[model samples]
Target: MLQRRRLLLLLSAAGCAQRPREPSEAAAAPLPAGISCVPFARALSGIALAGDAHLWWHAAAPRYRRGTVPVPGAVLVFRRSARLPQGHLAVVVRTVGPREIRVTHANWASGSARGQVAEDQSVVDVSPRNDWSSVRVWHPASGTLGVTVFPAWGFILPPRPADPAELAARVPVAARLAAGTL
Candidate 1:
């Protein structure tokens, strides 16, 4: 009985040892099947924008703050291209550095991992100006930064105001006057 208990404990310990030790490692683990990146990013970031991921940047202009900076809870918008005709979106999980960020997104991988959510994946800014106009996403299958440089439209931040009225009220007097709303 004592030997059986010892063996059981060792087996459990071995199982635990196989678990990912860090968020990046966990990001490499395959998740269950998921929807496309648009819905996933919308739900995760609470941005509420719709349509193709490429359209999100312009669509967010009136409803949310859009910028080149990456912030937690913001949705990074990729541009439409030959490879990604509809583009892509990823919710910023954390800023790793001036040129690197960790994101949670979906549908970035191919094969069995395609359309599945990936969390804490690394994204590095590869643009020459460091403005986040282009980026290299981490490829879990290859366990490295992807070689293809994807163009990005920047990030759409969660709306600060609860309603349109509040947002209009918060707008600067100069800007509102210039736009002839004041």
Candidate 2:
């Protein structure tokens, strides 16, 4: 019986190895065209940021504060270059580590449907000096970190604070009372 089981296992392994690897969804789909990351990020974040991705940092200079630190609700600004003519913008969803963050943006995935965007995608700061001057973004199509590490201008934080009334409405009076903070 043991010998029969060993033979079956070997056959199963061989069968699995013989099957061809199928193309991933990101690979099979068509490349997205005419989908700008700017408008997509604006719609997702509701920050009311305007203009091309490359110009966001410059535009935010007067209204929003810019820095290297990654914060949720801030927009990451990518520089304009030959490869990325118009540049790209992504909203920081959260910080995973000192040098790692998750962001949501459009046009990151080439084959996605119209208005289809990537959420909570990993982005790592791989700058040689650890200055957040360069980064490698996760690529869904290839299922790996992107080969091209693009240069970044920095992060832009919005000036508006969360509405006090909105926060108060979210926490029920009973719940607040239970915590003895009501």
Candidate 3:
């Protein structure tokens, strides 16, 4: 009986040792390349406006409805800074929560993943006011929210029949709370 118990323990230990380890984020496959955020966002969201990723905000103003409210299908525009000298752009795939969203974009990751498209990546509003003026994006390579807080110009809505009144009517209650207008 004791011999059988020992054999069972050894078998269990062997099975544990033979278990395959889960791949670390670093060990994950590299993202494919040859695309950047602007064209990807433009094609994905059909916003049409072009330039550096940062310039899309102002360039979109005259042509597209612009606001701080995030909506699915809207393009979030990152402002230019020393870290992101040319800026960045991502299409809102969906809202995850009041202050969290999933975005699809390209060129956000570094190294081999640079210029590659990333889909359904997480982005969280880190602004004190919760107005989405600043954000931290998920880093696929690191498997965590990126440490850098990037400034954002806001969202550019797709061209449609939205007038100011209709746009104003669509502002979520959370946005009104952020604006202190609620």
Evaluate all candidate structures by whole-model CA lDDT and list the values in order.
0.65, 0.59, 0.63
lDDT of 2 by residue, 1-182 (tens): 68645533432221000011112233323223233466545544445556667877888777778888887767788887766677778777678899998775655555433324455577899988776789988876677878888889988875543232332232232122212222
Best lDDT among the predictions, by candidate number: 1
Off by over 4 Å in 1: 1-32, 160-182
List model 1 lDDT by residue over 113-146, tens digit each: 5445667788999999998999998877778888
How well does candidate 2 score on lDDT at residue 40? 48
By TM-score, how accurate is candidate 2?
Answer: 0.66
- Give the candidate order by descending lDDT: 1, 3, 2
Pairing residues by index, what is the TM-score of model 3?
0.70
Q: What overall lDDT, based on C-alpha atoms, would model 2 receive against the true structure?
A: 0.59
Clashing pairs in 2: none
lDDT of 3 by residue, 120-174 (tens): 6788999999989999988766678889899998899876523323322332321
Error of 3 at 131 (Å): 0.9
